[model samples]
Target: MAPHDLIEVKNLTVSYEEAKLPVLDGLNLSLSKGETTLLLGPSGSGKSTLMYSLNGLYPEELDGKLTGERFYRERPYEAFNPGELSRRIGVVFQDPESQFCMLTVEDEVAFGLENLDTPPDVIAAKVDWALELVGLSDVKEATITALSGGMKQKLALACILAMDPELIILDEPTSLLDPHSRQAFVETVISLQQEKGFGLLIIEHNLDEWLAYVDRCLLMNRNGKLFYDGSLAQGFREHYETIQREGIWVPRLFRTAYQLMERGIIDDRKEFPMELEAISPHITHGFFTKKVSYSSGIPHLSLENVTYKHIIHPLTSTIHKGEWVAIVGANGAGKTTLSLLLAGLKAPSGGTVTLNGNRLKEYRSESLWQEVGYVFQNPEHQFVVDTVFEEVAFGLRLQDLPETEVKERTETMLEHYGLAAHKDRHPYTLSQGQKRRLSIATMMVENQGLLVLDEPTFGQDEHSAQEIITLLQQRQQEGATLVMVTHDMELVDQHADRVLVMENGTLAFDGSPEELWKKGKRWLAHHQLQQPFRVRLEQAQKKGAAAIESARA
Candidate 1:
């Protein structure tokens, strides 16, 4: 290994005992010091499997046969003593909940230091420095239970940073974060990398935020082969077609610029904006619009001055039959609490919640679920059945449907969600994306009048996300109401007819996306949101016009 190279892998192949082929095939890669590398691949492309191997958790700790030479800091990977890698390497898991092992932020950060036998004074100082680095010093004594989703993620990072690792591996860190929180987390990581000079290996599905910071890009083919490794821009530009075909995520801005180049709206020689600072010159006023009209009738579900004890403030909303609604907000903005109340999973602590003109309390639990389907924010929360097929079939069997009909519908739903092959496998054994599909499929088997889903497309790939959206659209057309809680603004723009923007446990804005967005970019920013590129481009055009007109006057 070169002096500058932090880690290197050559001819790595990972295989399971039951499978004929390897999951990762003859991969070769390297990471340089103080640089951020983005790993791109479709779901089930062995990204997580590769990540597992990096932090010394593979072959011995986790299941898999590892064959290939790997070096960490000029030393063979196998040469490291067991558990000693924890001092040299740090990992922030995809689910922040799984990474926490302490009750307070300070303790969480100090846990690793104590494990390494650092002096108490040194541990305390390191904890303070790590929390301060992540801008969470003020919350050092805060309880883990009180921290928001974003705060928990920061705490997780603080704990890792306290260890002072040379290399940091993050697995889809932004998958569960809201727009503003995601920006904060990524910016913090970037700042620390520049400050401390540690190498970064990130596995993320969303690329829009990381475009500017990524120094190198690695693309894995659908067959688990290392397809491309090069400079970020050229790799994206060269592999655009393959990326699209393999369901790999490309930034929306990149696609937007590509479309404009195709239409001759922009010169091909002009550089596209890789960073936020360069986006203004490329802005245009084209906007995608859609109109949605509700059918004439009473709302299928209504929350009249609904309040969930201290968790949610009194907020009123209504969902008309067949109308698809989306809820977006910062993390801990009462979205999940509101979803629970609407779905009848939790009784409102104040005010009234009604469905079909009857109070939620009046409906029988069995009948209420039959008419209302709920998909949780955490897919694991809903899994009670042992296997994937049994999980989906649970709802059908509840209504006492014919066994023949139940089998037919269950199999069809499984096939539709691309889980037919894993039907016999335990639901817990599936990937995060696959688990999300099972959650949706189970609810979809029965034709419920109302469905409330929290982050429906959480871990899905581009294609799987589209498939899930298509399923929801079909249900909407068939006269079902959809209330989705999401941080994905692009999804809201394309699918939701109306958007409910919540801030601080209360309804801040509720209207059509176009109407709410008309107040412009600053307005969205105040709500901890950045508009989609098209919306921002339109806003930029308007701002440019106003500046020119004022100058003439």
Candidate 2:
């Protein structure tokens, strides 16, 4: 290991019994102290497994086999005492609930310290310092269950900080947060890392926010091998095609600039812009113009004065056939509750929901299930069978379709969603991303006219997310109306014909994407939302061009 190396792995591999192959294979890597590195790869590419290995969770906490050497600060993992390794290398998992043990925020942060037999007075001071660092000091007395997704992640970080680790591994920490909240959380983490002087390694699929700030890029492939390990600028620019082909998300600015160059609309001779601020001077008039075009058809679903306890207040809206509507808000903002009411899964406390001018209450359970298909936010909630193939085929079999037809359709759905390789595996055994895809495929296989999906692309990687959205788009083009609840503003901007802004159990804004963008950043920020990347790029480009023209005059 090098003098500054915080963690090092030499030919490490992790294997689970349930999996057909090793999750990670002979990977050699190193992380330097105080360096901020971004880990990028497709879903199920062993990103999480690698993190587990780094923190001594793999083969120790899990029923897995590890064969290779891993070192922390020049000491082999086996050389150090059990709990001592974790204190030196802390981890913040994707699901914060998994790592938490105590019920209240204060108790949770101090749990690790108390276990270490630290003095009560020291624990108290550490708890206060950690919570304040993550900006959760005000909510120290609150229950863990009461916090939002962003708050939960912050609490998780606080727990890690109290341990005073030399390095922190964050596994998609902000994927569940809203656009504005996600940015805030990233900024807080970066600031804390700088102040504490700890090594930071974050795994994320969405690169829009982190590309501008991250120092190093560590990319893995489907084979669980590290392919590129270097600076972000060189890795992205030099290997753009491989990155895109693997379904890894290219920063939005790079994608747009590359496409324009390909079309001969922009000169390819100039250096491509990586950050939003640098893109404006290279921008041409109308280069990033957003052209909105959507057709409104007959009303497919309507909610009139809909009331769902205090979760959703009296609301009225009409969703037209073939139109895609996106429901977006901060966590606990009633986006899921409103979607439930729309799908006829949850009966409202008062008011009415109608389908084709017919009251929702009038439809039989079987009849309603056929017309309105709902995908739960938790993918595991909807699984009814063991194997992936059986799960997808379960609904088709209920329809009494011909065996041969069901077999063909089921096979096709599995292949399209990238689950064909895991067809025989149990649904629960699949990766989070793969499970989400299977849940969606089961509903889409039935070809329901109206689909209600909550965070449809929740755990999907760049490639898988695009495949799922493409399939949904195809269904919408074939006359199916889509109502999706998502925090991905880019998806909403590029796909949804209409946008529904939910805030504090009420409709804050109901309009087209263009109108929503026109509401200005301040109004959007007030609701805990931010403008999409494309819109930000367009604004920056205009400002940059204006400044250049003024300077020339």
- lDDT of the structure predicted as candidate 2: 0.87
Q: What is the C-alpha lDDT of each candidate?
A: 0.83, 0.87
Considering summed lDDT, which 10 consecutive residues are worst modelled in model 1?
Answer: 276-285
Residue range 360-419, candidate 1, lDDT tens digits: 989998999988999987788999989999999998998999999999999999999989
Give the residue spans of candidate 2 off by over 4 A. Answer: 18-20, 62-64, 120-151, 260-272, 281-295
- Cα TM-score of candidate 1: 0.93
Write candidate 2's Cα lDDT for 240-269 as tens digits. Answer: 888888888777888877777777766766
Task: Report how far off residue 410 is in candidate 1 (Å).
Answer: 1.9
Deviation of model 2 at 9, angstroms = 0.7
